[model samples]
Target chain A: MTDPPDRRPGGRTARVRAQVLDAVRAELAEGGHEGLTVEGVATRAGVHRTTVYRRWRDVGGLLADLISAAGEIDWQPPDTGSLRGDLTALNEEILESLTVRPSFAVALMAASFHSEQAARAQTRLWEDRYAQCEVVVARAAGRGELPPGDTDARGLLIAATAPLYHASVLMRADPDPRLPARAAAAAVLAAAAGAFSAGGGTA
Target chain B: MTDPPDRRPGGRTARVRAQVLDAVRAELAEGGHEGLTVEGVATRAGVHRTTVYRRWRDVGGLLADLISAAGEIDWQPPDTGSLRGDLTALNEEILESLTVRPSFAVALMAASFHSEQAARAQTRLWEDRYAQCEVVVARAAGRGELPPGDTDARGLLIAATAPLYHASVLMRADPDPRLPARAAAAAVLAAAAGAFSAGGGTA
Candidate 1:
């Protein structure tokens, strides 16, 4: 088959980009945003300082690029047979990413708070992730798992996932082994009660 | 009536502490964590730099003390006669704090990510806030609004409030006017269905 025009070539440029990004993650994990220097990344990546300066310009640029790189990954929402199972799997993935020692995910989130470019990039990545995950809701609706009428898929999805972020990232709470499934089950029950229906009210 | 022994005196120390913390909030709102400094805060508070240095010692100290000061505020959760109404009021308060121009709440959260002292102080403040809000659940249970068994009040509260933070702080989504009430309604429904009951499962 002919090579796809949009496919990235496995060339030296790709290799350098991968190396530099890896170095960025390592430096961020070790020293956080305050200590992430372009020079440090260059030294770690074995690239010339001038090359790093010319390509990435500053720490903000490197951070923005790192987030953009994350969006290129071929990630998919879980395909568990039930809505609750799917949500549980999704939450498990989120928990694992947040709980890993010196987590690149947590470091990147902290770095975003310190950099405007990174914040904007992080927002884009979040929107993209939400959009991707909306498929889970759509599948549930098709399977007759959701309540009647138009469900606010985005609202349901956010409700399902936000607790994990709130607990792990904001509160720095010790992980409760049962929390992922418990939160998912709560969201599923709420959704099934038409709580997430468009134009739904507290009445 | 006599003054309580534990009550803080309205003395020079109290006045200075208030002014310095006010300056810290203003500085954080204007310039974020990167620009907050002891000298700048002292200048703004009209206090000597040495005094600030002696008291706070560093930016981390300033951040931690600022958070501690927040805990001293005489704030109370809303008692709106129903779980959904109370939760809606709580969410509105949170939304206002997160969305105000040059939001001090957002700035403090960002600063917490950058400083270990701030992070610990923030965690304490969060735990305190959650503990204070538990009364909302207790009131709901007393009114026969909750299910028949023990409820996981923390889980329920987190579900009700996490969507706002996930939206405004994490994804930077534009404020949805109805979200506060809607999220509360969803959480209330889940709680009524025993989704937040102790030892609950997806089954």
Candidate 2:
């Protein structure tokens, strides 16, 4: 530990970890990326710098934990047996991820610029998210909810949410429930079906 | 304005301006929005501080000029008989914008954080681009390329390009011509048609 091991017999380790994360988030909010430092985090958390370093190999690791802990929506697309229902549920989940923790959101995005670890973490987060969509998509395809030969459906599904969520996160825009996702969903399915019918099923 | 206010000055003025813009873009490429500043840009351009400030009132103005001047797409959507041709044209333009001027791309995105001026500028740019699509849309509508009451077709046309464009810019990803635009165009139109035709052109 930089100061000394904060083996405070009065408190549990989990609580201390939470405190450290809270400090990191607060620092990020106050100073953008420039504010966060291991020593500063230690001082705020009342933990040793060595303790923080020990727990996380570096700054990125510590930030990664914070982001991972921030809150991810469970992969649960509604099975209303329609494409509309599936898309609505998916969009709601994306909105939740974007809205739940604003500071963590900004920090992760900014950190993604400077840290390979953050970029990888961000990429994995997206992969996990897109995988969730694929389940509902496959089900929709089987049920004929999606048009045949509409293999491009999933890409549109994500294109729907990515921009709206990105606008909220990066631009700090007032969340518009209907812009990117709803529009993409409405349009994507339309074009896919038209193209599919035009091509004939076998084509 | 930097070297001199000589509007009819020799090619030297043009070269100096190019050098400065190159420096700004380089800075943005290396470090995102946070690295852009008069001091940093001046250092990179090998120009005096007064020059940058004199030509452009602030970073926002300089950034705006860069966006309007260099980022202008070569062509807008033309009066094509099919919606597909117009949308393809528009999306291709967006992809071209993203690939070439990545620095200004990030700047356009980051500027949204600082002021409504940026938002207005961004919105105007989108609207201007959308106007280009509007012509093809109106032609298509008159020709029965779409149903009678297609409310979100404009939104759909944009969905093919905007979200994907926003993502590639923010995530620093290579712009893929085929998947994001072509797939999205196909899918979005399908979804839009489904939503509308199922509703008897009410959607």
Candidate 3:
């Protein structure tokens, strides 16, 4: 039997989903997680309550869909053939997310505190982001950009920036927010590069 | 007619005060900020209710003294003659605290969240700690350890590590429990060193 064609949106359903999701994000940014309710969201979107409920089983479901879109933010690592350019790009992506969609991040983190499901969801999204960096690290290792055989350097690498991103959004302090991200990316890359050189030389 | 000499610790008043303060900390840590109670603390210390109440005034006063003592985890920036050494020391302090006096940090943060007085106290403590770091940075800068004149780098620095401390003790995910503190310090120091070098050339 032939596989069915993709049932991706082309019309009103697509438009409504876009509109509702946008409304939800705006509400989250403006009012935080507590402010997200079907009635409030429906009112904001100019959509019916039934339509909102029909689309999202609950607030959690709505958020999951919203978060699912986080994956769309660029996940590909840069190939500058040097750690500096590659890391700079990585930091920029993280900085962009922090500056633009910080509230969503804050809401998700706060929610993750209380909800195991939210934590699981956040973990997946973050791991995917880290996976992008891992690819870079792997390539950098091969290119003598990291300490030899530090296969799980991604954890340490991500650890470096995780605090910066978190503090920026929560404490409302970024201090050359751009500088922090860029510096973080650059430093990790350089350290890896140095490590790789040393390791390879020893080997 | 002279200032009274510093009393020896074996004195009745000093001994009693120490007992009350220890009781307060123990009780607070056992639960959280909300746990501190004059009656409970007095009972825990095996002290008379009137004596405890008269000394601390209220739970708030008792908590204040306890925090002031606990918060004084003095940091003398290591002068290992390199930024990396300074950062490692800082990160190690963070890690050691999480392991040794975990409850102290948790109680302080929780108190800040729960009470306005505690919040003000916590902020003061932070302001002081940040000032201490500033002195360390200045020393590094004077010795030409940091980039020349990267003066506006404090916010990112604090942002980078504050959340790591906040998360492990506050929101608390179990994956790589030590990562928040270690990562925050490493990331910030690494990034800061790199950023400084970019402007003034890495030393």
Provide TM-scores for the models: 0.94, 0.74, 0.59
Put down candidate 2 lDDT per residue, A75-131, tens digits, no spaces: 465676756666666666666656665556655766765667766677666656566
Judged by TM-score, which candidate is best? 1
lDDT of each: 0.90, 0.62, 0.60
User: Candidate 3 lDDT, tens digit per residue, A23-125?
Assistant: 8888888877666788888889988889889878677767777767676766576777865567666666656766675457667655553344655667677
Native-to-model Cα distance after best TM-score fit, residue A77 in candidate 1, in Å: 0.7
Q: Could you report the Cα RMSD, in angstroms, for every candidate shown?
A: 4.7, 5.2, 8.3
Q: For candidate 1, lDDT tens digit of each residue in A46-113?
A: 98888889998999989999999999999999999889999999999999999988887887888888
| lDDT (Cα, tens digit) per residue for candidate 2, span B1-203 | 34545565556667667777787778777776566798888889998788888986577766665665543656556555566666666666566656775546555666544434555666556556566666766676677766666545555554556556555654555567664445445543553465433243223
- Between candidates 1 and 3, name the one with more favorable TM-score: 1
Per-model clash counts, in order, read 0, 20, 4
Question: Quick one: ranking by TM-score, best first?
Answer: 1, 2, 3
lDDT of 1 by residue, B150-187 (tens): 99999999999999999998888898878899999999
**DockQ value for model 2:** 0.36
| Interface C-alpha RMSD, model 1 | 1.1
Instruction: Find the 10 residues in a row with the least total lDDT in model 1 chain A.
Output: A1-10
In model 3, the Cα lDDT at residue B129 comes to 62
Provide the lDDT at B9 for model 1: 73
The CAPRI quality class of candidate 1 comes to: medium
